[model samples]
Target: MLVSFSPSLLFTRYNSNYSTMESNFQGIVPASDAPTKRKRPTEAEHIPTAPKEPPAPEFLCQDCVKLDLSKAFSVEDTSNETTKMAFAPGRWGYFNAWAVDVGHRYRGTIITNCNLCQMLFNSRVDEGDTKLDGDGDWLRAVSFLEICGLVAYKPHRWISKDIPFLMLFSNKNYDLYENRKKVRHLIQQSGYAALQQLNQQQAIPFSPKVLSPVFDLGTFQNWFDYCNGNHKLLCRSSKSDLYGTHVIDCQDQSITQHEPGMPYVALSYVWGQPQAQKAVNDGKRLPAQLSLLIRDAIAVTQAMGFRYLWVDRYCIDQDTPTAKHEQIRQMDAIYSNAELTIIAAAGQDENYGLPGVGKNRPKTRMEAHIGDVAVVWAPKDPQAAIKSSKWSTRGWTFQEALLSRRRLVFTEQQAYFECNAMNVYESFDIPLDSLHIKDRSKSYEYLRRGVFGGNREAEFGRLNLEKQGPTEVFNRYLSNVEEYSARKLSFAEDSLNAFRGIAQQFWYGKHAIHNIWGMGYQTPPEERTSSFVHSLSWRHTSNCWDLSQSPQRRPQFPSWSWAGWEGEVQYEIIDSKQKSWFDNLIRAVSVENQIDSPTALEMIAPNPDATCIFPVVIFTAAVVPSKLISFNPNAASNKRWQIGKYKANLALSSGSVSESQFAEDIHDSHVWQCVCIGAALKVSFVMILKVDDGSDLWERAGIFAIDCYSHSLEKMMETREYKSFRVR
Candidate 1:
């Protein structure tokens, strides 16, 4: 049954809808009474003012939504609760009143969250409130209203398609790893009232110089057309410019249709699964359950009368950060002044009633809230649930769920949002546009590669190396790699070619889609049949945005063997266990190791024996310090140098740096050498290494490799490490 939630500090109430019409039903216009349906002469459709449908709705069948999470704010006085409640209506209403509501239905339930600001005007009626008279008054009202925007640290994929865990501020402003800390701190403790001083308190700036609006929402008769192609105020735009700006730039220029695609709907993509196919479908409870949990929590606080929900996406506009940051910085006052700070997380021990398992793992934000709600999901049928549990057996599944829920929110003496090691930088909100992750066009964005800059399709040369003659394909890839001046690929061109070659040959080697790994389109929930069905969608805001999945995006000077390679460097299992961690895996050594020779490199490499290629991935030192420095972590700190680049061809250099390990091992100082052996291929590279460790900052260095691999491993033969692992 559909349930309407109450207004609470965590869940915003919507009894008073700002939209003109509650629903859209098509019928003949009365002309006398308020016209509910307008059959405009085609000319009126082109008029400055026209009625349109509201934003896409939320899923109706969702039985559960995640529990509401509170802003990480700190308040010292319990007496402040009443005063906080006072600021609830005016402040919250003033900002959200401009938003238009859209009802999202999944299964049988309707989600009450509004879609976007545009939907507000789209819900026009023929009456005095919001009739479409070709006038200019309403546009003026909206234009004059101070507009605010927010730019977050998340990639467009995370913020626009999936469950975007919001950031309190930009990663550019602070360190990125700070998120892990804040999350940990809140889980272990709950004295959260001392974090109020560190919020972003800057206000949005506005300009009044430009004008020429459109129809008014309240009167519907007034019209204001400000721009005649000359002056520029954001609101004033031609239809072409408006449409051009519609998609809202999902960040990858290569994939933009340059036109608006689908709009956001809370649970729309999930419930459509069963209907899409048959018994092969699986539903996602993450988003739906999270929403319901949040709604229920809002109810407890709303019973006491408070309303203001601040989610990052719809609530805070992203394009305008100054204004959004100010509101976010005051999250302490905003949340503390109002009613409640609902934590969406559940405690593993409490919710699942499995205390033993939870006691062992470290506490986390999600684990602390288990006592808040009890949940259980019914598969479409007993058999379907059985099939689904093939991977995560029911008993283990319960433990996994329990393991995920843990949290605590502590506070500093200062009364502001907690911005510290423990809190992590989560903004306590989800992004407005996170649901679009399923769209193929937006998800596998790197595939398109933006070769010509328009929303261009990716040009994948058929990598049927066997058909094209492996030599021909390999030579073509080499020719292109050698042509580039940069040692590594700054773009996706080289990588894309490599993977397409692998996809044509080896994807079927393991003979399974699950193991083959797409640079797949943004994976859609309704389409996921198993836990392993993952899309190469961006996972987090941890970096700027990774678009290197497709073959068209490969690195420069990359081996065709490295074509399907992903991440900082390409790796292959020359010999690996079916399920052992130590199976022999061959990795193309990145420039990080400064591996002048393959044998010494093997001692200190993520994947041993892959030659040091100049185009190897340049990883952040924090993530892979050994790769950053030539010395191993076990080496003395004084002996360690942070230098990353290695000479591309060590054999050619007459006075290359001395090998310290060999020097220590030898009795004679006469330039002793180490390790002689099998045939190995070595490719030298001089390259620019760069990475986005969330700061958008780039660092580069010179480097090279001499890699060694045995014929057995090259044949994908099992090594001691490879043979020991098994999937089960």
Candidate 2:
């Protein structure tokens, strides 16, 4: 005989033992058993009854209902303790243990016996059922419970691979899941189709058309043919002007003469540590020893149907200084004119070959799953990876990447195809329309025009600079320096040499702007004196301006130029909003080039030894009286320099200038000369200085500024006589 178990029977059994158990199992009291008597409250003893809560929503489950109570677990104590524990550890611990056991048993039962749970575990829902409230809600609840570790389910292992098991487990609503699934499915299918197109050498229709992932040789060939046939700008080069002395013949698998205009793929990579690789000589055969990177590049070039490949290690003779210098000068054109550039951005050194180019290339995906959805974690933006790569951080590689017209970047995540018109990746597929392509093309065209001249109208129009003035051109050069300064170079002496290509491009036809040292090149010859002085007003963006902190590695360059520093530099003179008042006050008296020593002009060939030529500029300027003021708020006495009726503050630290001598000057002499003017509005004046040794040569001592403009100072400036001085 089996005993029946019912809520009424259970309540009846526990009703006699505990008064709180008088209610039904649902925590609801029967209407007949509820209190009927009414209690009256006296005027002196007012009683406040507890507020009643509304019934739980019908949509909630039985477990949800139990957990939804405001105070589900509570204890009433009749002891002397003032603070009563709401929940006892021993009592709740037992209930928790029982609940865990019951949940485990239920999970086992669902896994082994529940047909509905098993059927839906790895199955894709139909379109109609996907939107149905009952089906979606139930499936989502089960998935959420599993993800939260409240339930044990292995849908990914036992179900279909295409099923998106994680979608059901996601906390997002049905509409979001649907939209995300559609996009993900499209990307997945496009990736598959791209791989198939490469392997089979067959074209397949892909949706949303912009995806261009090059996984194999066949796909790369297809893209190459399409670009060559369609893009008018991507014209083939004649075999005469290429700069490399040697290039690897992809077809013959041997080194050959580098012919100009020959269609060859160039490799951009990091050299890493010095490797004992064979260099090309005056021979027709390939080197016996080759770096892994060069070998991989050769293979890729051949596979992509190119007959020749240019790599720095084999192409340029590093042992010969003359050959290296000449090649370095032509680096910009070499990369810019390449048929295609292969960037090994993911690799740290030459030993690390391009992924997917060699037999031992590492695979990007892992065999993992979340539910039935085959999870693939790939970089969403390959350009970002390329930018952050070790290759990009190197000084030479920056110009290489910027100059290249088209590039096939091999990143750690995936391959990306980029040209002036568009950038496409394997993981994401977006079609390239003419308008979008044109937008991208215009940007590159602008950069090219700025570096390599094309139509000047578009370039000047974009920058909104006056066509006659070189201010925008100067700013553009500084922008290049700003980026180049942050990059790393192995040899400090190669600083100017590495930047020579870009410098040549910037100063292409401008005869007035001479590439003196590095700073004076941007200034016109007529204004060389004033411009050179203005250019000296550069400040370190990262650290305080200190001459001692400047790197002495390249002492051939002067401390006044940014080329002397090993870190980033920014010019304060380029602030366009500021009205320059010092340009007219200072005049260039004479400019001379000093070679070897500080006091000589000699004709020398363009040799490495002769490259360290410094310009000595002489200027005539009106000197004004100024003083350094202590602006430190914590100082004992609030002292400031009185300029006429207005008080002025020091712009730079006194320590950066004269140290203890600055303090002595402040105590001994109340006068200081104003060397140059700075940003307008605040009307900053750079303090003038005579060397501590009492030499006629002058330098910038410090900076001082007044809060407001004073017409009285302009009258005082007219009364002052101009003095001549030599600047080194």
Candidate 3:
């Protein structure tokens, strides 16, 4: 039995109510007028502008002639409840049809007046196929069978084999069956307003679903309830109090302390083109004129039955240095313990409201009908939408998402719920039992959950040592840093601050002694020497679009860390082939970092034995004296320098100071030193440094690799001088 829903109930303002399912079939293309059976074609011919009327026919194909389309088409009312109605669902058929590679003549006649066929043919013709004449005007009488499951016959075979035919199936069949070899139809906009209403009504009943007309508050509340009650991995313990110190009370329109065990929503958004933010007055009330993004966030928080919303701009006491530093230090905890983070990922900046909340989001899906069949044009990937948004490019938002246990993302297309355990979307239902988290290539949650195996503490414990050999755990950290470095940061100095949460999570989550300057080292005092050297061996990529953009030093940060640079760096983990070279190098004797305050470095350093007074790192290692033979600024990085007699290249880490200038400074002295860190494939990786200000301290000039096959390993080590170097 066909179930018919009242259009008024499905769409509140719809004027056209659905009549009882029409059983009678008349005036929907007479069976006798339908095309007769014919041999299938191998090559598509030019569709003439006007085909002459056919004479009395041969035998007919009953299946093709019996298609009744009037039973499938209907019009729906829009939000205004006017006399004009929008398009609605109609009858649709699904078949596992084999696409044929043939000409147009032998193709059998089927549904000769199909609007779908005409649209498809016309669209294909518009792609500059001059060899095919007749501007699709003749397609008004062409058979649907000619274009079924295929773009066109031979002469118009512009479609690639990998491109799937856009087949439209019945709503029920589309959800019930797996997409295999199916027939496709062209999806066109029959009516914009009508199609938008149709999408809401048609998509109302699926599980893990979102209601139509966007930002239906009740629907969003249900998603939170479901995830809260069902996803064990996303739940926070009652004892946890990592939420922000201050939160905005949505109902009171004021800021207040976040109570323990109370659920609060955090917000992640781009604060594009800075504007002055006034501090909350004595009353603790929110500012009257808030950005649309924050205003929408408050409404959503209230709609989800939560009173408190944590927005960084308002929650943190930005004017107070101590409070700001305290909040910044706890960034990891702030995001991790939130009930869920609301990510405003639709627009360029905070001024643009969240789509579907305060703003009326344009419909992303459109539907139209042909006879009894309905076709739709819908975008399926939510990840693509989020990735394209301006919010994804910001440096701070990276850590915000990475630390959050659950995130409710609002993109222009739709809203979606992402957690370590599952992903739910507003557009349609996805069966959770069949979903494998690792298979989501575009999802950040996939990377988040996979890195720590859904339990950060346990995963950290398991990877603290290289008992059986090196694990991918450390490599994952490097991969994340590489991505983070490429992202845009509003202030270059905030580079480390933005990535602090991720760094702290790894540094202090389990074995504290394993991390130094955001790089991973092995545990135990004996193993750290080699791990430390390996961590320092990262190199800037040579294939960058412009070398000037990267390899630029962040003067405030130490050169030993990737954080000291403005761009991406890559670390090739020590492999068995290069183990000999790594073992041959001089081991680090001791390392110490100077910081302003001990409490400032994530409150506590994981390594209690190491000093963390300031941002400078002092270390001692064997250094080799080498002459600066020549320097070529124009050459590619691999052949840019000549150190001693070996062919070498330098990865310059200074953008402000030119290599030519440095060469000029050392022209008469010609004194240079190479601190060999590791080697592989007869190549030695070394850090080049020079005496700083005629003092005992040495400043890193750049990193270089020398071809070492010409000299023996012992010969290379014999020329070294043991010395202590302090780099700031």
> Quick one: best TM-score, which candidate?
3
**Per-residue lDDT of candidate 1, residues 1-728 (tens digit):** 01122222212223333111111111111121332342322211222332232212221112112322222111122335665532221121221212211222111222232221222122121122343233221210011111111111234332211111111111112222333344223222321111111122422111111000110111110001111121122111112211111111111111121222222101000111111211111121112122222333223223223222222232333456564444433322222222113222223211221111111111111111112221111001111121222212111121111111111111111001110001111112212112112421111222211111011111222212223332233222222222111123323543332223222222222222211122221112222211111111111111112233212222333321223333332211111112211111222222332344322222332211132232322221111122233444355633333223322122111112344542232222122211111121232121222332354323221122323233332332222221110000
lDDT of 2: 0.45
lDDT by residue for model 3 over 1-728, one digit each (tens)? 01122222211121122111111111011112222332211222223442332211221233223333332222233334666444322211211121222234212333333323332322221222344432212111111222222111322212111111232221212221233122122221111111122223322211122223345443345555555555544344223455348888776778888777666789999985665666644348776666777767776665455667889998888888777877888888888888788998888999887776655566333333533333333333355567667888888998898788778898876777776555556654433332322343222221112222222222212222222123344544655676676677877788788888877666643344355556556555555665566667677764223445756667766677777777767655433311223443644434444434223223333552242234544555666554435677787856667766677765655522556665554443334456666664476667766656666656666666677742443374555676656665
Total clashing pairs for each candidate: 125, 8, 20
Q: TM-scores for all candidates?
A: 0.18, 0.55, 0.61
Per lDDT, the best of the predicted structures is 3
lDDT of 1: 0.21
Query: What is candidate 1's TM-score against the reference?
Result: 0.18
Using lDDT as the measure, what is the rank order of every candidate, best first? 3, 2, 1
Supply candidate 2's per-residue lDDT for 578: 24
Candidate lDDT values, in order = 0.21, 0.45, 0.51
lDDT of 2 by residue, 201-299 (tens): 322211112211224333444445445544544333322364546777754556778764467789889996775545566455554555666766765
Give the range where candidate 2 is weakest over 10 consecutive residues by summed lDDT: 93-102
Instruction: Tell me which of candidates 2 and 3 scores higher on lDDT.
Output: 3
